[model samples]
Target: MGDLAFEPPRGGPTLWEIGIPDRSAAEFYIPDPDPNYINKLYVNHPDRFRQYGLWARYTDLYPDGDLVYTVGVSDYKTDWFFAQVTRKKDDDKYEGTTWQIKFNLETVNQTGTYKLRIALATAYVAELQVRVNNQNSNPPLFTTGLIGHDNTITRHGIHGIYRLYSIDVNGALLMEGENTIFLTQPMSSSALQGLMYDYIRLEAPPPNNSTKKI
Candidate 1:
């Protein structure tokens, strides 16, 4: 063996990435603990997410509507809430929520399949449905049906079990200019049923010459 070399398989080129893939949502916005439910150990601490009742803040932050995030203009640290949870209703019931992410593309690949990579920091009896462009798509683009039991939200923890999903997006569903991706968590029996996203990314279709050995 004069020389030995190995090259890993290449997936595709990343078009855009949101949040860091560190198996935790710590990088995202972590609001201060409510004054009524403060944990002194976490006050003004980096692990502010560990404080109790952080999940309830979602309703307080956006009382009238759900989250609408614009890629270029919004700042993840301040705009992206750490978790996607249900909203409390005046009837003393909880309801599901849908968050939107809007982005723009100068061009699109008409004949190739794009990949949407989503990493979950934690989940608790939740179903995540993803829809591209068409918010009312009956079947949706992808769905994680009834996943996870890691009650990280109520336990005052930042993360628990980690999961990653790669969804194939048909090129035809994308547009040349403005596009929107909707993330819906449809399990609302309890406030604890939710998901914390670790990271999310979209990849352009691989080129014909994607594989190479060097």
Candidate 2:
């Protein structure tokens, strides 16, 4: 429900609580990510087109979205990550997809609610995975449906943005030590021209349920 981006440094401790927030204008429904729950979301069409930064679509090949970057993700010519949509029509229910990330830690003590933060930033489109130790925390993952998709982009598409829904663990890492985190993002299906990436970070809970206000 909050934004914790551009903090001190990377691989360091995370924000105490109030995990990352969704930069998109669309409404999100995540019970909040943790080491346990494998959440799945359905991003309805016309709506994906109706709300958020994806406010409009282009007339490239299909009725898809576009990456905001001047260079394409596969262009290898620039540093920007472009995330477009592959769907042709606007009524498709969209399809299901998954991105795998790996994280490794020195002590495996980096325990907390890990989230797969998905923003529309096209620059972060590479296969980014963090591994703690050597285990692939949880699978099944999350995605937006592609029922009405046209699958004509032939390039990466943006279905929805995900974030690290870090749920608080009562200092669980103290029980272990070091850890790693993984992040993997495929191309989007729509043909729109834009990329989005909000900040992805971990969180800790506030004490006694005080100092909190939505």
Candidate 3:
């Protein structure tokens, strides 16, 4: 739920451990589902993305900002539609192996500025970009988790860390309504893939209680 991180290369890929097997003052107390929704979910299969190719739609593909975002993914192969958006995985063996595009309330209500915290699920080769509406925002808030060029990565190393990333609206910022978030990675491959997003937080307006129809 917050910025997720790994120790570094060699820790064998760090993943956000399940929240509550034990009780803690700072931890959220969640009981196991009677049937475990995640276990029975349809998207956790190895061929889920394969049916839709590597890349899949993240959210409702709504318009929240002022840009048109064109999207794709590259797992060092073709663009893929990474799933698992949550730390909770299907088999639970390597939940960290998958990446997700789901967003939280904080991301949905993004206002002034927003930031994404990413944690490496596994040590996989990877790159990431954020798009809005349909266009890759100019200057692109996030890039290959790298800077400059020359196979030179800024957040390169292992366990990548990135911040800010203007995103779709830019100076205009994101609005309420429907929006989209995309995350991608290979199926348990050894590359830069990680938990695409640890968490999304923003400085937004007060909660909307309006019943008015848009």
Candidate 4:
């Protein structure tokens, strides 16, 4: 089969298609939102990492090999997202492959709910885990098994939208400061074809300002 890269629809008619109509819609479609409820930080694309204008490290790979890196962004084919981690033919198969994206929380030392929307494409059991402050070797937060058999759908590209919203079993949000969220796929020839990561979005609940007297 020819490698197909599906492009998301243009934004111009999304509101209308979704049934939000007319002039007052301007308020409904606030591009540059003023600080308010539900602060959202969407890691939808590799380039979005640069917009913060900070020197924070955004992408990293372990046991580097051929086909294991981020590519340029495209509307559809080649480079729209991170490629699957593939091992070179000469490399030991047992070495395994992993890719991670980090988010540094500035509004820390607080308590609230957190959520993540990730798109992953694969044919193997992929481990989705979160480690806070580079500690805690607990089991993965979620495991995505074979695609069709396990509630996975091909919504964008070959990947399916996997939404994770919950406090870890330890009852903690990714920690107050630097926390690393990792996605690991075990060693297999199937993995060699690639474990595509389309996008990830991390969102936090709004701060509780209700207690303050107005």
Using lDDT as the measure, the top candidate is 1
Q: Tell me each candidate's TM-score.
A: 0.91, 0.28, 0.31, 0.44
What does candidate 3's lDDT look like per residue over 58-164, in tens digits? Answer: 22121121112222221211222222221223343222222223222323323323333333222224445555433344544545553222211112121133322
Give the per-residue lDDT of model 2 (tens digit) for 7-47.
53233344321112444422321111232332234243323
Off by over 4 Å in 4: 1-81, 89-94, 121-132, 146-173, 190-193, 207-214
Poorest stretch of ten by lDDT in candidate 2: 68-77
- Model 3, residue 138: distance off in Å is 4.8
State each model's C-alpha RMSD to the native. 4.8, 15.6, 15.3, 16.1
Segments in model 3 whose C-alpha atoms lie over 4 Å from true places: 1-111, 146-171, 184-214
Predicted structure with the largest TM-score when compared to the true one: 1
Ranking by lDDT: 1, 4, 2, 3
In order, the Cα lDDT scores of the candidates are 0.87, 0.30, 0.29, 0.34
Better of 1 and 3 by TM-score: 1
Error of 1 at 140 (Å): 1.1
Angstrom error at residue 19, model 1: 0.6
Q: Where's the lowest-lDDT run of ten residues in candidate 1? A: 205-214
